[model samples]
Target: GTLVEEVKGRRFAVSGSGFWQVHPASATTLVDAVLAGADVRPGDRVLDLYAGAGLFSAFLAEACAPGELVSVEGNRRASADAGENLADRPNAAVVHAPVERALRRGALGARADVVVLDPPRTGAKEAVAAIAALEPRRIVYVACDPAALARDLATFGRLGYGLESLRGFALFPMTHHVECVAVLARA
Candidate 1:
């Protein structure tokens, strides 16, 4: 695993290693996703599922100024780095646990105004289900895998959420890997 680095001018901290190595484009894509679809407001609660190194969590904390921003990460090293990265944010909470376990425990409480998910290539089935169950006002999904994104979007659609918009970013210029952002809202 490579060392985590903080993105300048943003509260996010991202790892330099992983299945999708953190590069300038990938980091920018994540920030762009948050900026385009967060729909955050003061006093709102935000959830960052599959929050690696506090990237989305930090962004939400800064952009939303919400009542709280809960970040969940399954990897130990990533979680530890997330804790260190988000330590300065008073409204942020970094939980070192699987997204599913955190959601199952109701760690996010009854409601969240905004939910952001940046899961792995496999997508986030259980996390998506939990978000649906919580019925957040807005959902921002960042995916590196289009197929998984489509599958998860179908599930969200079945749960009464419609895809509002979609955007693509060329994170890996030389490779087929790309970053996609999707906004979903209740129908």
Candidate 2:
């Protein structure tokens, strides 16, 4: 089964039981947040980590057309869907690998102008250093856990990436769960 979500006029094909924003408004909200925070320019090389089903990859690829976009995901099913979802964009490459390994291996590229990090609840502790090593000018991180986000931010701070801004969304109305988008810039 598949579920298709339309965000800001763009349609994304998501696998059933795969990760998709649970809140009805979350997909749109997060997409808007990420695009604004990224501030990607035309031909700016970009990387989308943990790019489930090519959600952000599609938009990023369009923004960076003729530049490059490497969307890396560890989930086999999700990566397959991402390949299909991003098929229309020749500038985007969907890689089925762990984000950490991809970054560590320099498989994606040597550098990126903008990087979008949407790691799981555990945060991207394992990949933070590797990502920073890419020396991206900006990083937009979408985090679902505050503690993990804080820890990763601290790690990023040590890696010369400073938090430029942050926005929080209460997607889960009655629950403690909240989604946060933090923008970081190289310092």
- Report the number of the highest-lDDT candidate: 2
- In candidate 1, stretches whose alpha carbon ends up further than 4 angstroms from where it belongs are 1-4, 10-21
How do all models score by TM-score? Answer: 0.90, 0.97
Deviation (Å) of 60 in candidate 1: 0.7
lDDT of each: 0.81, 0.92
Best by TM-score: 2
- Show where candidate 2 strays beyond 4 Å: none
In order of listing, the candidates' clash counts read 0, 0
Q: Model 1 over residues 44-143: C-alpha lDDT tens digits?
A: 8888888878776776887767488888889987887789888988999888889888889987687888899989899997777888998899999988
Q: Enumerate residue pairs that collide in model 2.
A: none
* Candidate 2 structure, TM-score to reference: 0.97
- Candidate 2 weakest lDDT stretch, 10 residues: 5-14
Candidate 2 local distance difference test against the native: 0.92
